[model samples]
Target: MSETSALSATGATESRLVGVTAALATVCIWAGWLIATRYAMTSSFTAVDIGLMRFVVPFVLLAPIWIRKGIWPKGLSVTNGILMIVGSGAFYTLMVASALEFVPASHVGILLPGVMAVWAVLIAMLLFGERPGKVRIVGYAAVVVGVASLVALKPAGVISDDMLMGYGLVSAGAFMWACYTHAMRQSGLGALEAASFVGFWSFVVMAIIALFTGTTIGDAPMGDIMMLLTAQGLLAGCVAVITYGLAVRHIGSTGASAFGAMTPALTALGGVILLGEPGNLALVLAVVLVILGVMTASGVFRRARI
Candidate 1:
């Protein structure tokens, strides 16, 4: 190859490598967030309190950057930004916190990311007229089967009405995230811009809700509060958002999203090690199936084969 062509090829390869690294880092942060949130729920902190903290710290730290960048989205971008805030911001956090109360971290790992992958593909098909090839079809089927197995094979006394409600809420949160991602792609906003916008508006909305609902961050242990503030706010809220954006920009959304398959198993393992949550045969099987399905549906494996 010509020197210029070789240089271009090298640049493309490096960019994709960076994207993959970012995607993997994002997954680890998300898994850590799940574990931290579960731990916080054991303290005096309510889900709303945790959600409030998620926005508060990030907004405080990122506000100046947002202003300096002059990053106000307009028109449909504005609408999409609002959707992103509601879908993946405070509302999503609250849903996750509440769900964690009823279910274990393992369940959250499986349900949230698993449902999200399924929804992302389904929404793309329905709204964007994207046709799934044969491999993708098999992948989708595996996702469905894995999710179903999770529900059906949950430990005894874990499938009560309240737990089912929690599952539904978590599923809703996943769907909202999928919507936020779609809007973000459509809005053409940079990752930092979108993250800052969502953080600012999420703080505003959560502040209003806290005022009306009398939701206060009760006097929890200082360590727990600090952990929540740092993990949810800085790591998952700011870092993961930006990195995931970079992943999408460099590697395409489908390829970046394929990394989500690893999240469930990682979260489940984290829960077992950190939270003392039980890991069973069913959870293992579900994780394997879901990861395989996501890899296939997102065309990661197919692309690698090519």
Candidate 2:
């Protein structure tokens, strides 16, 4: 095994509080990123354009570290290398960016966390045999109902090809992310190394996609494009990616997955302040319900493991 794996094995039992805090930090960063991403997506910019920059910023930031580490982890098998960089990084980015094209940032905020939490619970139960208790199951139900209401109430003339596609894509991204988290744990790769590997390959795949699709430059408002690229590439890429990778390493896959539930609430709040998206009554109620459900599900309400 690699040194990263060995270190993980020795430190597995070090501290649960630390792990949980790390996961929480990741969620906060992601929530803030969601707001910025929504603002970045306008009639002027397409998802592909945003995605290209996501890869570019990270690749540039990691250039030195990558050079020093010699590009690619020593212990990463070829299959995992491809899966992490391509499957986890590039593919997920494609799904999310495309979805954001049609879906409201609020909808994304609600759905992203719901999908992630539910998937985490299911995957943990099936793959790792970890079962959430009764409270958590009920909490999961609240999340489902809350998300369903948002969809059911989607404005009547507003549903379009783009919106439907966006939802599907984002949901797929969530599922892929869940699988990636589990796979990383199973593979025993350390967080930093995994992040670096994913960054390298994501950059490669995105570049290929940009080339194939013919990257859209000077197509959107130059100012918006610049802002989007900087946020997605630097804040979301360098900071968020590195933080999340470290979080997943400290928290087990299941616990880390729980943090996703907060993304929607944070995003919704962001929408109100940043995007001028209305804070409807439904938004407030949904946020309350989701927050309570997440708390209950995380076993804070009861001593049961979720």
Candidate 3:
């Protein structure tokens, strides 16, 4: 091979390595966010408080970008922008945050992503005519089954009355997030642009709501508040999107997303350690199925076969 060709190959390899590392960091941030959000909801913060915190920090930090691009962002359609705001912003945050008041972090982490995979694929199929292979179909089916086992079956003694409600809310939130992901893709928005767009609108919407109804901002311990500020505001809101898109750019979307298959298990383990949330057989079963299903749905195995 020519020296130039060798250098190009090395560059591609390095890019992929960076993507893999970023994906891993994004996954950890996601898991840690769930755990921290759960702790905040159960102990100190209300859903509205979490929503404010989640968007406010990012919106302030990204003020310069949104100020220049505006909320609609020059080339993005109104429809996609609305979808992005409602799906990933205050609305989605409140749904998951309220649900966290009743359910474990494991449930939020697993159910949202598992259901989201199904919803996202279905949306793509309907809107873009994207056809999933046989493997993908089976993977989506597995995700549905796993979710059913957790939500519908709900082991006898392990559930509370509000648990079902929590599950339902989180599932709805997942649908919104699926819509957001698709809208972002359809708009061709850069990761930072997308985050700023969502954060700015969410801050405005939540602020308006706070004006009318007032907020549940809490007097939580400073240490806990600082934790949420970092986890919810900075890492999950700002950095995760950028890293995830970077991963997609280098490793391809399928390769980058397959790493998300690990999040359910990571959140479950974190719940056990940090929140003292008990892990049951059903949790284990759901986590395993969802991981395998998300990985398969992401086409990891299919790519290897090809």
Candidate 4:
């Protein structure tokens, strides 16, 4: 091969490696966000408090950038800002936090990312006329079956009415996230631009809500509060968002999104280990199905010619 061709091959390989590494790290931090939020719920932190912390820390950290670039940024549209803020910002945060109040972290881990993959695919198909192969069809079916399996376990004294409500809320959050992802793809905002827009708007909106509701952080221990702030704001909110963007830029959105398949099992495991949440047959089965379904829907196996 020519020296230039060899150099190109090496660069492409390095980029893929970076994408895979970033994607995996993003998933791990996201899982930790779930676990930490669950812990916060049992403490003095309210859903509003947790939601506020998520944006406040990131917003403060990114303030200089806003000052330099201005709040709106040059390329990002108003619609992009609105969609991203509502989809992944305060709205999504509060939904997940409220759900944690009613259900285990394990449920959030499975339902949120699992349903998101399914929704992203369906949305693509509907809007773009993308045809699903046989493998993808089966994958979509598996996701449905996995979710239904969780619902089925409800009558066996496993899932409660409150849990069902939590599931509904989380699912809605996932749907909003799917919309956000789609909007971001078309928004022409770079990763930092999108993250900054989301952080700023989320902080403003949550602050307003907190003022109206008289929501305060209460007497939650400073250590616990700091943990929540760092995890939700810095790690999951900022770092994960940037890393996922890197993955998308490096390996394409399809490859980056396929990494979501690992999130369910990892989050479930984190819940069991960190939160002492019980792991059962149904949860395990759901995790397996979700991982398989997401992998299939994302075309991981198909691309491998498996």
Local distance difference test scores for all models:
0.83, 0.71, 0.88, 0.85
Q: Candidate 1, residue 65: CA error in Å?
A: 3.8
- lDDT order of candidates, top first: 3, 4, 1, 2
The worst-scoring run of ten residues by lDDT in candidate 2 lies at: 297-306
TM-score winner between 3 and 4, please give it: 3
- lDDT by residue for model 2 over 1-306, one digit each (tens)? 999998887676565666777777777778766776676665555566667777787677777767776577676667656656654687887777677767777778887767766887898999779988787899988877776666544565256777778878878887877778666766556655566667777878777777778766677667877777767777777776666666667765555656756677888887778787766767767776776676667665454333
**Global lDDT for candidate 3?**
0.88
What is the TM-score of each predicted model, taking all chains together?
0.89, 0.78, 0.93, 0.90
Candidate 3 similarity to native, TM-score: 0.93
lDDT of 4 by residue, 1-306 (tens): 999999999999999999999999989998999999998886678889998889998798888777778877777777766778888999989988998988788878888987887788788989889888888889988988887777654546576778889888888888889889888888887777778878888899999999987665766677887898889999987898789988888988778778867888988999998898888788889999988898887788877784
Q: Residue 261 in candidate 3 has what lDDT?
A: 85
Identify the runs in model 1 with alpha carbons over 4 angstroms from their true place. 1-20, 68-72, 152-158, 216-218, 246-255
Judged by lDDT relative to the true structure, which candidate is superior, 1 or 4?
4
Give the per-residue lDDT digits (tens) of candidate 1, residues 146-226: 877776555663578877888898899999999987988888777777778788888888888888776646667777778
Name every residue pair that clashes in candidate 4. none
Candidate 1 is scored at a TM of 0.89
Best by lDDT: 3
Better of 1 and 2 by TM-score: 1
> What pairs collide in candidate 2?
99-166, 109-264
